[model samples]
Each structure stands twice: as structure tokens, then as C-alpha cells.
Target: MNGNRNSQDVVVACSRGITPGMPSFAEQIAKSAPDAADIKQRRWIYIPYDRYTDRTGPLTEQSAAATGVVIVESTAKALRRPYHKKKLVVLISNMRHFALEQAARGVSVLYVFSPKSHGQALVDVQREHALPELTCMTPAERELRLDLATAIENGLQMKFAEDTTWASRTADFTEVYGTYKPGKSYVMDRFYRKARQKTGILMQNGKPVGGQFSFDADNRNPYKNQIPVPKPPKFRPDPITEEVIAFVGETYAQHFGEIDGFDLPCTQADCDLMWRFALEHLLPHFGPFEDAMRDDHGQLFHSKTSVLLNLGRLLALDLVRDVAQAAEAGAIPLASAEGFIRQLLGWREFMRHLHGETDGYRLLAGHVPQEHRRFTQEVSPDRTEEATKAYASAISKADPYAGARPSALGASLPLPAVYWGVKSGLHCMDTVVAQVIQEGWSHHITRLMVLSNLANLCGFSPRELTDWFWFAYVDAYDWVVEPNVLGMATYADGGLTATKPYVSGAAYINRMSNFCGHCQYDPKKSTGPGSCPFTSLYWTFLERNQDILAGNFRLQMPYNTLRKKPAQELMQLRARAEEAIAHLQSFKRPAY
Candidate 1:
């Protein structure tokens, strides 16, 4: 329905369920509505946490006013995985604020505080309102989409409106990539080039504006004390946000990250300001240092816009168009503009498209060695406190390479405590993990080059690492994290998402980041006590997986190097890898 529809034409439904320890804004709204009983009977629009704003989709103030709005706060959903505390605070607080904004706009809002899951809460709303039909936009994550589809199949009169927030839709993805083929691999460059042509972004006179679709080659210069990195925009929590912080702190005490310094944009206005900050301050240097990491700066030259974009506070197309205009106007360099556009119109869209097209977890499930596949059955939910304790106990007591027999192949080691926040004696890991713990934010480079790379080398279960990423990052969702962790970083999907595993020893890490300088292990060494774990593990991983990886052309150089290494040297590298794994397994975790 259009935004200008009359109130008599639509009914608004609101559910009054609040997550525990949080104030019931929905309940307060219900009590204050002009006709509470009449409001209950009206058809209502339901706004999930991910769709809390009107800027992205069809949910404008006038439309919401016609049929009332249902905003639900569900404890069950938040606890599905012990999400980063800052992530919870951002999501719940933005949702609460959106409800208040709607109420202030003369829209009858039913804010529900439910102890049940979001699905159950929606069912409650359907029954309470006696509604024959409910309308919601397609959810971003596949799991939620499937849940809603099942509800529809089971006789819920629900209609899904098209999601208009993204730059590209599912049909567009299909047009470019066709249907997903199980064992076939897809390259991102071809998809990116097609998207650029289809969208006419950075195109001039029927050609790319700069005669090239990507400036990635020009975008990898490390920060060598050239220009000072601009600080990312930070919003001080207002009273509403402070209350959210307090609530999240008390309720999700064990969740990762502290909520005290939560500074993410919660409103459209805040999002706009952050966007401007990114364009004016960060965008210029963003391209050159996009792959660079620093020990002192966690956000270094990166646009902290992913969280806002994922949360629906900012629309992707709008941001991309504005960025393109700035580039066209010569406000930012071509490399900077192209790099940013590539992320928005290229990688981001590609990941989301792949996520919808395939079962990423299922694709990797078959490739995991039988012994490691059973590891999933043994562990609880991979990131919970119980799972952490269990994994720690197992690692400490069990042989580090117990199941990884026949040359340490099919290694399925559980994630260690070091991944969360403990000192791993590796400066790169310790620094990045600490950043993830404190801020729940890290740029793409830190995630792939440092975090996921180390996890892959350590032989951690791909699913376990993927789950940990889902629980840890603010920008993480099932759709994004699964493809990235399994397909791109770890190559657990057997290179369906990447041409080759993005694996490297300390040389690559040191080249891209300042992390190795502070590390206890020498980046140049491969087998000594001070040997870099990544360096030792790098050779070992290549040796163990050589039979499987030999045919891949991209891996030929690495395989050649492995072949050239002396037999005794290869054996010593294996011994070093075993020692490293054992040490990592037995390392004591310190209380943070």
C-alpha cells in the first residue's frame, strides 16, 4: 500500500514484548494510544530490528500511519547467539528509537516486548489483532526469509513486499551469475564488471570512467607514516542510548564487547553525518590504505559505514550514487572513488547474492574430513560460554592433532581461547582480537588477512570459525559471514567463492600491517622457538594439502616452493607445526 492510504483502509498491529532488563517502550505506547482496544484489532505493519527505519524500503511515516506499526523486542532472538554486546545495544536501541520516531509522527505504534522468538511474537500479533493478512519486506538473511516462507506455507496470511534497500536485487544477481551450480566456482571480477556495466556506475561514453573497472592495484599502499588517519565519527550516547547501554550491560553481561563506548549511528540524521564524515575525511586516503592495518589505529582510513548500511539506517544505492557524484566532481581521486564503489556495488552485492543463491554451510560440510565433520556434533553452539569452556577443556587435555592424522590432513581443531581475547604471543592476532573484543569493529583487511587467515592456518573448524565471526562482528550476519569465512578466507568450499585460498605466511601479514613488528616470533624464522606460527603453519598447510591443491594453477608457485624445500627441512617444518599447535592448545587464557 502507498504511504498516503487513509487510516480506515489499513489496520496497524503492534506486539508488546520487551527483551528482559530493557524498558518496555512498546508497552508504554500501547497504554498511551488513543484507543488501545481498537488498536489491537487493527491491521498493523511489523518492523523487525533490521528494518527499523523508513528510508530504505516502502515503510514511510504516512504508510505506517495508515496501518499502525508493530515493533517487537524479542529476547529469544538476541540470545540465539551470544552476539557482541555492542551489536545488541546498536540493534535494540535503534529499534526502540525508530518506534519512538514513528509514534512522534502521529503513527499509531504497537511496541511489543515479548519473551518469545520473533516468529512466535509475530504469530501472537496475528492472533491478537485477528488479522487476516500481514505485510513485511523480505528479510536480509536467508534463515529469516525461510522462516517467514514456512509461516506462509503453514497458512499465515502474510505478504512479503520487495526489499528495495540494496543496490542489486536477486533477479539482477541471477541475470549476471545465472543459477548457482553446486560444484562450479564463480569469479567476482566478472560479476563486478557486469554490475558496473549494468548500473552505468563510473561509466563514461559507454566505457568505464577511468578506462578501468577496478583500481585495486593502486589501492594497496600501506600507511607508512604518510598522512595521519582521520578518526571515525563517534556519536555520544544520548539518554535513550545510555538506557540501552545500561540494559544491554546488565542483561547480556557475558556477551562479547563492552557497551559503554557504543558510538554507532542510530538514526538517519546520524547516518548522514557519518556518511559526510566518511566522504570528506576518510575517502581520500581510504583506497591507498584500505588493505593496511596498524597496531595503534583500529579503524585506520576505513569508512565505518557497514554497520549502518547493514542495520538499514543508510541505503546502499544512495551512498554509492553520492560517492560516484563526488568522484565525478573531482572531490576524491578516481582510485578512491572506484575502490569504494567496488566494495558497495561489487563485493558487498556479490556476497549477498551468493549467500541467497547457495547453502554455504552445506557446500563446505561435504568437504570437511569425516573426523572433523563429526566435531560439529560434539560441540554445543560454537560461540556460547558453555562451548568455550568445553573447547578449552578439550584442547588442554586432548592431543592437538588427534584427528588430524595422515600428515595433519582434515584438521578440525576447535577455536582456542586466544581467538576471543587472550594473548597468543602473536602481536597481529592479539591486537586484532582485542580490537574485535573492545569495539566489535574491524576493517576487511584485519578480518581476512589477520583473523580468518590465522584461523585457517591453525586448522580451526571452518564452521566453528564462521560461527565465531557471526557472533563477534557488528556487521556480521548469516548471509555475509558464512560466504566470507568459508568460501573466501578458508577455502573450505573448495574455492567456490575464491580462485585460491587467501593464505599467506608472515611475509604477507608484515607487508600489509605493522603487526609483526611487535610480535614475539620472528617473521623471518620458520622452525625455531621464536618462529612465526603463521610461517611454520604456512609450509605445513601447503605440504598437507598439496595433493588436493596441486592441480589448481594459482597454487603452482607455492607448490613448487614446497617441492624444492629439502626433505629434512620439510620434516622439521612439520615438527615445528606440531609444536606450535600443541603450544596453542595448552596456552592458558588470562581473565580479561
Candidate 2:
């Protein structure tokens, strides 16, 4: 913790920067409150939220003992982006529920309706409480961290404690990677191996269990229709949740997705139930079909525990131990156990470290253009409605490449209507986008191989794609989406987080999923009306970016294959690709 020692009156200010729904910090303070109350300089606590802002933190019995908690319905964060209706509802409802829970427990709660910013609301809170000093856990988001600093600079005596929610810290990342080096890319496998050794997870006698660090090879078998996919555990909405649904429907009518069918786990009991269900029903088959995609199945034996983990309802360290114990007991396969552990203990931690280390890749010049405007700025809140309308209108009147990123290779194609749930005649793209719009969730394979793969291949702006992901997904945060989109998916970082761009053609999609069977275009075709857009665009993408990508050893095979194609055939494919691009850009919403 960093703060002034002289200040007699200090209040803890908990913001929804990360671990939104957890009551860990509040509980810690509450346990010490009785002892501190005897002293003249007793420390108070405050938790604040804006109405239309984001997801709310859940309240527990311990948090109900807090001296005071504040809730504000701020217009600043609500209109920050046109967040999904369901997303807004989830946040506001959870907050309202928490506040109500606290009030019922006899905790003094200050629920405010502040139309301004969170910062201004904090100032109002300070005046009401007559608190001279404020301290909080360091926020996970870079912007929110800056906001806290600004508040301190602007006269609020503020201090921040180290955020201990995540398994790894910035110091751990620095100890592993050393100082930031430009143009240096760290591989995930190496980092994962180190993490396993350090944490002593899956280790025996100083060696990895099964004499291997990764079971990724064993984890890739496509679903052969042998095993039935398990449906995710669902919870019926209670009165509190129902009220949130009605409130969101009225307030954010313009936001995306339906407010009905809200079945997410909001409390500790709900999360516990979901976790048990995953361990029993999903874990056994999760590893083998982890990357497989099925049109008929959405969950596909995957654990939908990300929301719970991120919200602090479930601890990452605890979950890892549970998985390890289960694996040792022979309840779940080693491959399944190891794969799931790698996600929480490996990729998830790496993404957070990479997000902070890269600083959104702003520190690395020439990877992406300096003048590239953020999508949020373009759709400013003042003119958000007009900007959205204009974007829709422009999609109809413009070329696909009109607003694409103007990088060295000129991948300047504006995102087409297809990404916004408009049918693009391609079954894979249509299905993925529709699912995202409806549910605000998709398994990683669908996101990477299908959604991000097509975006990278088609030259959609990386920043634009990242912003779409930020607003669209329920579990998305700046710390996760940036590296995933720009680094792993789009290769916008010029091969930093990912060794190579995760771009794929129709062949990869056909091999992994059942989508091709329903598509109007043939996955095997590379030209003409029947040609799959992904097939044509794959070649065009390679041909256009050969200057930058031709030297990559991993891409040599695809380059050699492109070299063998007849000149006439290549030209026809390029023409077909342009036609496909135009069709996607036409802004004509197709009937499903």
C-alpha cells in the first residue's frame, strides 16, 4: 500500500476496475473493523458504481459490514460505448442487488445518480462523507489506473494497494522477461513451462508429469459425433435479475442483444454450482475437442468459468489446485486437467502480463501506424447515435477498403456489415457473429479460428476489430482483448505475442467444423460464384503481404503452394476475392 502516514481519516474506495463482483477486499477490512473502531482514527470504506457504466460487484455478508458504499448511475460511462443491452443490465443489476443486500444488512449505503464522470462522483462522495484521504486497490485497467492518479493530482488524497487478484504480478513478469525489449517476442510455451516449475503445479521430482509439458497434440481431435456435448449450467432469473432486465430494456433500448434469456451466475452459490457441473460433465471431453467447432453445439464440453474467475467469485489458484487433485484421483484425464490448468495458469496470466508490458503496443512504433485512430474516438459519445447511423449508411455507399488500417501494406478495409450480424452468405461468419450478438459469448476456437481468422485474412482494421470485441463480449476487458486481437489474431504487432498471424483459409475451417456443409459457397472452390470468400481471400492476403510474410519459416509451405498455382488461376482468384469483398461491403443484410 502507498499513502501518506500523517492522514488520520482514511477511507477505502473500491472501484469496479477488476474483479467486479468479488467481496474479498471488503471482507478483509470488515474483519479488522471491530479492532479499528476502538481507535480514534478508524478507517472507513466505500464502494461506488455508475448505473449505465458496466457490470456491478456482488455483495456478501462481510461487505455488508462496510461503513458506507456508493452507487451512481453515471451517463459518462454508460455512453462511453454503445454497450450491449444485456451487458449493461448485468452490470447495473448486479450493483443494485449488492446495494440492496448491503442495505438489508444495515450497512450505510449512498446510492447516487450522477450524470457526470466517475471521478466527479468520487468528489461528491468525498464531500458527503467528509473523508480527507482515500485508498484503493490498484486497478487492472491502464486507463482506470490513470484516472485514480488524476484524482490524486486533483486534490483527493488517494493511495493504491497492489492488486493481488491475479496469480502473477508485474514483478514476476519482469523477473521472467527482464526489461521491455523492442522487437522481442516471448513464446507462450517457454513462459508456461517456467510458470509450472515455479508454481510446482503438475511437477513430480522436479520433472513435468507424464514426461511432457504440453498435451496439446492429444487435445486436438475433432468431435466425431461420438459423444454428446453437455449444455452449460443455467440459472433462472430471480426477482432482482428480472428487475434488471426490465430496467435495461427501458434505458438502453438501442444497445445490442436481447435482455431476455439472462441466465448468468451472479452469486457465490451460483458460481459454485457452475464449477461443479463443469468438473463432472465437461472436463473429461474438454481437452480432446477443445479446438473443435460444431454448428449444432455451442458449449462443446468447454468450461464457461471465465466470467466467474474474472469477477473474483472463484480464485484462479484455488481452481488450479482443485483440477490437479481431480486429475490425481483419476476422475479426469491428465490431458484434460493439464489443458485447463494451462489456460488459467498459462495463457490467461500471460495475456494480463502482456497487456501491461506492451502498453497496448503503443510503446512499439512502426508495428501499427501512429496516426491510427481508436474506434471509440471515432464514435464519440456526443454523436454516437449519428455516428452509428452514418457508419451503417456508409457501409452501403462505400468500398470495403475505404476505412481499413493504412499500415505499410495498405490493409485499409473498413469492417463490413457482416461483422454486425448482417448475413454475409458465408455460414461460418454468419453463425459466429450471430452468436456473439445474441449471447455475448463464444468458445475460444470460434473466436480465434473463425472470427479473428477471417478478420485478419480480410484485412479488417485490428484496432476496429479489438474495439468490436471489447464491446461485444461479456468477459472482454482491455487487458485480455488487446493482445488477443492485435497480437495473436491480427498480427498487427508484427509478430510479437504470436509467432505468426493465425490466418487460415476455408480448408482449416472445413477440417475443424460442420459449418461448411450449410454454407452456400464451396469451401473447396477458390474462384467463381460458388467460391468460398475465405478461400479466395486467403490467397489474396498472402499475395498482398508477401513482402512482410514471405520470409517466415512457418508460412513457407503456404507461399510455395501459392507459387505452384497457375498465373491465370491466381488472377481469377484475386478477381473472385475482390467480388467477395465487395459483396461483404455492400451492406445488404441477408435474410437467414
Whole-model lDDT per candidate: 0.73, 0.68
Segments in model 1 whose C-alpha atoms lie over 4 Å from true places? 1-43, 61-64, 153-155, 360-372, 375-411, 588-592
User: Each model's TM-score?
Assistant: 0.88, 0.84
Q: Could you give candidate 1's per-residue lDDT for residues 116-140 as a string of tens digits?
A: 4455567766677665576777778
What lDDT is reached at residue 376 by model 1?
Answer: 32
> In model 1, where is the ten-residue run with the lowest total lDDT?
1-10
RMSD of model 1 against the true structure? 7.7
Q: Residues 1-592, candidate 2: write the lDDT tens digits.
A: 1122110111122222224354532342243322323221333333433111112222332344544444455544554555666666666555655555555555555555444445555666666656646545455655455544555666656665555567777777777787678778877877788888888888999998889999999988777797887778778776556655655565445665566688887655676799989988899788999988888887798887876676555677777888888888898899999999999989989888887886756666654453254443323223233223322323453422122232433454677778778888889888988888888888999999988888777777777777778777777767787777777878877777777778888998998889999999899988886988898899999999999899999999999999999999999989988888788789963321
Error of 2 at 421 (Å): 1.0
Top-scoring candidate (TM-score)? 1
Q: After superposition, how far is residue 146 of candidate 1 from its true place, in Å?
A: 3.3
Identify the runs in model 2 with alpha carbons over 4 angstroms from their true place: 1-42, 46-73, 99-109, 366-410, 588-592
